[model samples]
Target: MWDPVTDAYVASSDSGAPPNGERFMLYALSQRTGLPSLPLTSIGYVDLIDSSAGAVGVTLVGTPATGPPATYARYCVARGTASVTSLVGFVTDGTTRLELRVRTDSTAPGTLSVQTAIAVAGRDVQLSEAVTVSPAGGDTARMTTDLRVTSGGETVRATGDVTVDTTTRIGSGRMTVSVNDGAFATLTLGGPDLVVAAEAGVTLTTADETTLRALFSTSFELFGTVRVLFTPVPLSRASPPVDERALVSPEES
Candidate 1:
């Protein structure tokens, strides 16, 4: 039994909530339409190729390499292009360039752009650069960071960490991918190259909404903060959707 008042899982036999040590499934509406909204038996987050995180954007702000403010602030952030919130770390020598992995939406191919800014305490600076990259639907692209300033050379490397009060916030959101179930099959995606530590119920945001939205729309399962499950659920694990056509090439057919 579920007590909407208490907002927790409970046993039908007992009036109280399930014991801490005891295990139970929480129920929720299935994201997949046509199917009854039941306890989501499977849940997981959106996984980007090569990296653990989804699409992300970063901005680099700095001061003149000469005086007043000599250090540069590297804003490691998420979203298509938004204000800097958290600081991953800092580097000096006038942040010359930065590399970022941007994810591509399903319908928007070959169209990817990210913005970065650099502020010089007492000088003017140019902060937008464009680079071309090739990425598949629901994939990632490595972008080059561009920054220019008056007086000093256009290129600068990190010298040291910048002293700034910033919190590290990981982006989280609901996502779903499908996979084939023929007895049992294993799928490997570029191996686990990127690592972002998180747990259930953590709110997240995606840098590339197009890709993730399309994915969840067709996905049989979903990854969310709360694992809503039906009273009776399956014990099998959830996996990304599989494509039979991709398995066999034109030559094979």
Candidate 2:
């Protein structure tokens, strides 16, 4: 089962190989325009099994490629409205490349409708990508765009945003905050505030201080904790000891 709200798989079952040579059927269903729509896949053959309960269905067994361009397609057989022999679908096990395109419809101050589109499963489909609007003025500024991945009328991935900030020029802008994209977390540098926003269910970590420093300056205000190293130096020897400065400057000595 798929959870439309969370965009996740709820429960699943697998019947191994239809119990030795028993023929079974398979069906693939996807969403099309707010309804169940079928996509293009390679399903060579399928057979149906009728049960005493008046239900018709088939068991799905075998592993498919897990990752990018992958989608959840219901693989099952149905006899009629009240009799679905077997109800099963894809339980994805890996990541997919979710592409998002964002642009504003208008630059006027009121409510700039930022448009967005997400491409998944090798198909370009329309999905909402508007999270927040950009601040309007003669000068350019940053805007945040949110996205939710949906397929066959079910949300596959939850909502997230891709924000563009510091629009210095037409092509000279950086993503301030973004989520759900397959790319690395967004990196924002300004006003002494350093923010790192990773995709949902993903944790952000730096390998070492050098890597962190490269992304943020020492004075940056990080939202989380970090490891700091402090070196200790031995106290100056009792007395004035030797004057190394006078040694280097003979005239002063």
Candidate 3:
């Protein structure tokens, strides 16, 4: 029958000749336009075959994926006269997230995965490196990036990470040190020094249980609690001490 009011085809048969509804039109459009339609994982209306007594036809399921990427064919499960829903599912690398909703007539809740593609901003760099520079001959050394240091003390007193991308590089380019008398340790400069320094002859106790005796410099941010562990040492105390003929911050503080 024709829906004179809407000017579209109306239900002229009993419960609409077999599968004759919007689905029929959509399916026809897909066939004619060669456009793919949604796929159902499974299709099963509440029927007498598998349904117990008092059950009504109301379900459509797509074939489950053997492992992943389960393809769903477009279909519907009618409870009785009017109840339809849609569902889609797929998987992709964690670079992305997916979410899908499958509608239904029943009150029970159901969930289905929807998204399949994901991407991240950067390459997501995850790496660790340590470059130690012990300035010699009274010269400063610089680094290309920030640094992570573990000052020595019982059971290694300090451990921290920092990014040193600074223009004012360290004066000392690089050198090699005996790592706790174990082996030759190469120390190179990284970003703006993620600087660890001391006065001409100040000492710092490090985690390696070694008191870097003030043989050449003081502890790098060695005075206070280890809370300020990673970033640049707080300048308040690190600034040049109040001494005769000296500014708060030395020319190179």
Candidate 4:
């Protein structure tokens, strides 16, 4: 079963006795009733169990049914030693689907990296970010991000490094953005609001302007200080980290 609110898998079952035949089943708990469950729509399935196989193999896939069909898709499961080290998922706003990838930093114990890509509607955007939690105290962390957006044969890129106080949920940093490798526009953070300023003689093409507007509309609040559009999840209220290595095998890991 799956919990829509938490977006987590709760339970699973297999029926019909293994040796003879069996069928795998997936379910989701109804939010309205919270008693009876609902079966997930299975768009695809793969069977890896085989008696003739030379080695034991396992493949697991997850399909989330809570969100809009066009906006959500199944994720691939990566095997880890003690937990899931890597994850791949898809999210969309109907017009475009963004590919989201997340993984723990093997070299850095308490660090995480998130990458996102969007290639649609003549636009290609990619973002790579690294977030590291302070080992001395979990109340603080650092995030470094790089973003690139391309459209109509033009390209724009931005890079930022910020320190965040997990306890206060406040971040301070400066992001520098450039269009077509031209002069950069800087956005400063950590003050009352985000502040943006461009270098002298910075110019933009018609296509570049359109792309920037679309990006700002979807990702930032530009009225005063710029703020990213996101739903904040406080670390204090967040679930404990799961060791992804345990979820996968040695070969997969």
Candidate 5:
């Protein structure tokens, strides 16, 4: 049955048995249908499944509704026993893609593992990190990430440690960047934007400065902070009424 209020399809088994044994599932779909679409035009789908182990698993996929159709998929599984959860996902927009995997277990508290990869414009970046969560020690989590970025020609890499306060939702980290196996700059994370500083005793050549400007921006040297922003895209056509909802749940005049 389609529930417009929830924007999901709900299905249940017909067998006259207890709900515990019965199979239940839901598929939710989301799409923008108006004159103006968000800067990132996308549609989303979510699938919720009930397993015999009494655990619910979710699979979500999203793609651009318009433009080059590139898809992203996310999978998450929660086990009834051991309170273990695993998540794997990938996001891509034709030119760029990011893959992430995470695993956590309540049975073994204060430990988590994360791995990520990014591919963009012939460049590849990979990161692996372990996080330690301290519930009593200031309610914070600390992680050290080893990152490597490589293209067909030059290679860049970084290493950083980030501390996140779970309660305050604030994070602090500093990453030292190296270009072609040479020290380049350091990036500090915590404030509204990213702060960049040159590595001590490292002088940037003209080519190095050009590379940095190309990677960051022309204002990379003038402004130490980098801010990323996005703007919405307006649609030319108006949205049509959702007639499918009436087939499931009729509206009163």
Candidate 6:
């Protein structure tokens, strides 16, 4: 059983204080919720973490030795487009659904954009860039990432020039996609020779948001090279909720 008075995962000690191991575990789990480990020092100072850690507007401040500061000495930090505590889970917008992305683009607040059949909202995220979004319900998000986006709670990365095309639908879980080098090559899109890596469980859903356009919804490992005919089309939700449709034409002009 858990003890509230002692705050231990198990029973409290005779001294009423938790063991060193218990304290470490409790502190670590708390970090996942945007909570700081605090003034982890030998000194008596205790740092209190705030709740708005992953948001883009949080800030901090520090007291300089030269300045009088306030009545007492203190340190502070300012939030600079702060990102999420971790790279797992989902971002729901009530009725809609979306995913988060990371990129290596030079553009700030422009590298990332929300994509859908109707409209999108963009953000600037880069390599190793972590973020969090609380949708009104269950909205979908298209993203850009340089890290190998993994599956099953952002664990393993699927290496390749990844694309959540007109027929893509990530399931309800923590799906991570990290772009590890050399695993993928280029593709001459629109050409019959073009091919894509189809991992297990990774489904390509249609614009209707109900149709199963393409099936390969799992973890796609790189066996060969995938070239890029056009620039890497970062995933986005646009006019049709989905694009990059495959077309069939007549033989005769």
RMSD (Å) of each candidate, 1 decimal: 23.2, 27.1, 25.2, 11.1, 14.9, 19.3
Question: Which candidate ranks first by TM-score, i.e. highest?
Answer: 4
lDDT of 4 by residue, 134-249 (tens): 32355555555566767667777776665555545556666677878886576666667665666677655666545543443232222111111111111112332322221111
Write the residue-wise lDDT of candidate 2 on 198-248 in tens digits: 656656676632343343321111101000000011111122112212111
lDDT of 3: 0.24
lDDT accuracy of residue 33 in candidate 5? 50
- Ranking under TM-score, best-scoring first? 4, 5, 2, 6, 1, 3
How well does candidate 3 match the true structure in TM-score terms? 0.15
**lDDT (tens digit, per residue) of candidate 6 on 1-253:** 2333444445434342222212111222245444433332111111223334422111112223455322111122222233211111123333433332222111233222211111112422211222221111233323222223323333223222233322233222222232233222221123232334334544333431221111112122110001011112212211222222211110111
TM-score of every candidate relative to the true structure: 0.19, 0.23, 0.15, 0.50, 0.46, 0.20
- What is the lDDT, from 0 to 100, of the residue 2 in candidate 3? 31
Best of the two (1, 6) by TM-score = 6
Error of 1 at 219 (Å): 38
lDDT of 6 at 196: 42
List candidate 1 segments past 4 Å from native. 1-76, 80-91, 94-111, 135-253
**Candidate 3's residue-wise lDDT over 1-253, tens digit each?**
3333554544444342234122122121136434432341222111112232322222222222354332222222112223222222222233433222222221112211111111222433221122122112222322222222223321211222112212232223332233333322333334343234432333434632133322112222221111111112121222222121121111221
Off by over 4 Å in 4: 1-71, 80-84, 88-95, 99-104, 121-138, 203-253
Model 2 TM-score (2 dp): 0.23
Q: Residue 157 in candidate 6 has what lDDT? A: 35
Off by over 4 Å in 6: 1-13, 16-138, 141-144, 148-253
User: 1-253 in candidate 5: lDDT tens per residue?
Assistant: 3444554445644453234333222232235552223232325444454543534444444534456533443333433234444444454544566565544343334443333333442445543333232233655555454555566577776666655555454556666778788888876767666556788788767676555434432112101100000001111012211111111111111
Candidates' C-alpha lDDT: 0.25, 0.32, 0.24, 0.43, 0.42, 0.24
